[model samples]
Target: MTQTVMHLDDTDSLERFDAALDALEGHLKRVFADDSAEADRAVLAALQEQVRVLTEERDRLLTDLEAERARVQRLKEANEEVSGRLEGVMGALKDMAPALQD
Candidate 1:
């Protein structure tokens, strides 16, 4: 026996619910026959697996990029510190050289 919902509208909330139920029922029926069921299951499983892998890869890349940015910031700070020290040393050298000449 086929079960059907009447007045199916994709726009209305009730229609959406009915459509979803109908789709599930069809998927189940297709799943019953060996060839149809197996093919549908395989396609769905493959799609879900691919989505999972891509999600993980995206998350990993985001983490790596953030780490790289942080490292760059730290190096910048270190470079600034070195620059300040060099300027101070140059100033001292200038002062000592003038006194030695006098």
Candidate 2:
């Protein structure tokens, strides 16, 4: 039996996630200080755009994760099939050894 391990390095994603949070925070601060209607609308638009970008990034990461999981599953199934075949061959060789000793 062989073991398969997966390591995920998500530094870039984490950085992006952090940046999005910071942008949202900054937008909130601006919204609180700006009293004019136009300024408020502009801030709201910026916030909405940030949300859209973050949502897209989240979706992309989820898709990538699902794909990786499927790949790992396929690899595991292939490994099991190969292991079973090897064991069958070894058993057959063992069975033939006694007859050859005659």
- Scored by TM-score, the top model is 2
| lDDT of each residue in 1-102, candidate 1, tens digit only | 994544533246434544655565565555655564446667766655665565565566557656766876999999999999999999999989989999
Error of 1 at 58 (Å): 0.9
The predictions' CA RMSDs to the true structure, in order, are 18.6, 6.6
Candidate 2 segments exceeding 4 Å error: 1-44
Candidates' C-alpha lDDT: 0.66, 0.77
Model 2 deviation from native, Cα RMSD in Å = 6.6
- Please, what are the lDDT tens digits per residue for candidate 2 over residues 1-102? 995665756556656776876787677667757776465567677877877787687778767767877887999999999999999999999999999999
Q: Which ten residues in a row have the lowest lDDT in candidate 2?
A: 3-12
